[model samples]
Target: MREQYMRTGDGFLIVYSVTDKASFEHVDRFHQLILRVKDRESFPMILVANKVDLMHLRKITREQGKEMATKHNNHRTSGSSPSPVLWGAITPYHHMLSKCHYLIYHLTKRLCELLSTTCYFRAHKIPYIETSAKDPPLNVDKAFHDLVRVIRQQIPEKSQKKKKKTKWRGDRATGTHKLQCVIL
Candidate 1:
């Protein structure tokens, strides 16, 4: 049943209570399951540390939660070159100062984001949001909104006039694959 839900989900909101350490431990499992089910190294997911209102009983520190959320920033980079952000841009003599300034500003911002442990587009890293889960629900709405934005960012535009008919399969008696539906 969990696998079925994972298969159909376009995005995921992985929530763990700050008062429970076991929930925090399960974060890695859920993340891995999402990757495995999607058969992709990266997916649109938001790690939410909920129950932030109970600060006194928080078993997980803010730093710990953030570190867990960012654990996959460098998950896999096999044979990949440096990111464009890290590369210096070439410009004319007059534009050198402006480019340098821009570079400095960008780098500083990135550093701050990483240090603060909350980021969107921080090099394919997952965004982490803290939620209170109380009456007001701190950041709960933002978490969902951010996940939607992430999903939107990942979906490719359909430029072709002709649409492809997507096919899905269901489990068979022998645990083999069989065509379940072909919806146009």
Candidate 2:
């Protein structure tokens, strides 16, 4: 049943909890399953580490997640496979840009956010986003949005013409029956 969805899904989000070491270890099995089901060398996948709010309980490091993503990331896209999304630190305020240059201040701040996210992905690879679903979530929406972009990047431009939408109706409550692709 799970294989059925994997066969139909265009993209995947492989989510693992940062606090669960065992869950992180199980990622490879799921990844291999997706490949075997798709029978493809590469696919659009985003490796997500959730539960970031509980930093004290985190068992997986960000570096570890990134290394895993690089191993699983596919670079079929034309450009740097995985560029970036909005994230990272804010730039230091310039002494010259006082209260007088309020417009520059806002633009610079926005630019800084965009630039920070790209630094990690410049090498071109799968996105590894750490998220927390608790109140005041972080990167949850970004993860899904990035997955869409990744899928779009993989498809050939010629076939990108909009196709008729087909609605899928599922009878079971199982995750597989409703959507395509595994989220574990």
Candidate 3:
């Protein structure tokens, strides 16, 4: 049923509590399931370690989270190229909703920047932000904005690639230009 639900998903955000080792371990299984279900070599995904405010209770260190992300980033399906995996830490200061919003903004920016350097295009970036379950209003708003931005960025690139493919087709018919368009 989960695989069926993910069939139409454009991207995925996998979250785990920083204080829960079991949750963190389950991430790998979820990732594998997604890959097996989608049958895609690479896909946009973000792994977030939440509840960073409970630093003393954190069972998953920041380094461990990063390592996990890196492992997934290097993974490929059916001999395809590696995919990009972005990870982040977020503390949901439920007592102060405003602060949580502010932190989410900063986290979004930083994570997006880090994603820019990866093999994925600017449009393929997956955003990761941390916010408490209690801070519902702001977290939802910010998450929506981030999702919109990612979709917007990808739209132009897809159009441009389409145009390029059209040009390549024209060249092929003319016999004056030799080229190929490989859709991946």
Candidate 4:
């Protein structure tokens, strides 16, 4: 799967059940394999620990899942500053600011919170959906849709040069030709 993803530059959504220790171990091994492959680093992955209804039989605890996420987040830091959400607070605010500025500040804070949460989830390669195949509250189709949304959100857009199209270059045929030759 990793090889196929690497070769095609396609993302993957891997869902696994963690009912037993062996299955959990398989997840760990696959996670390590993903890290080792290195080529799929940019590919999106949604690691779902499904079948939470069978928690009585679960070998992997929620805390273990969180720890795995933390490990991945730490590994991918790249010496950059910690996420704003992780930092917990921004600089001190001005007392003279108007209500509109206060509202903007709060809005910005909320936006940062959302971004950081999403970043942490993607960085850790952990996307969990608690669902049961039997007596399902959220159906399989919805779960898959959610996975796609998460994966799409996780994929960071690459910086590309913007080409100016004047009347000469606006010809459909010429634009198509240029697009065909432009390599990513």
Per-residue accuracy of model 2 over 13-120 as CA lDDT, tens digit each:
555555555444444555567778878766777655556677687665666655545564632111111111111111112221132123212322121111122233
Tell me how far the alpha carbon of residue 74 in candidate 1 is from the true structure, in angstroms, after superposition: 12
Give a tens-digit lDDT track for model 1, residues 1-184.
Answer: 5577567777775555555554544445566777899898888776555556776886657765445455745221001111111112122223432443343223321211112233332534766666653455456456556667777777764234355666656476667676566489
Candidate 2: segments with Cα more than 4 A from true spot: 66-125, 157-184
lDDT to native, each model: 0.50, 0.49, 0.42, 0.38
Query: Which pairs in model 4 have colliding backbones?
Result: none
The digit string of per-residue lDDT tens for model 4 on 1-184 reads 4354334422333344445343333334444455556444544454444455665875446665565556565211011111110101111112211221232223222221112323445455565443344453333334345545654565545323344453333457655432334558
TM-score of each: 0.54, 0.54, 0.47, 0.45
> For candidate 3, lDDT tens digit of each residue in 35-56?
6777865454554445555568
Please give the lDDT score for candidate 4. Answer: 0.38
Instruction: Tell me, by lDDT, which candidate is best.
Output: 1
- Pairs that collide in candidate 1 are none
| Best-to-worst lDDT order | 1, 2, 3, 4
Q: How far in Å is the alpha carbon of 132 misplaced in model 4? A: 1.5
Q: Which ranges in model 1 have alpha carbons more than 4 Å from their true place? A: 66-124, 157-184
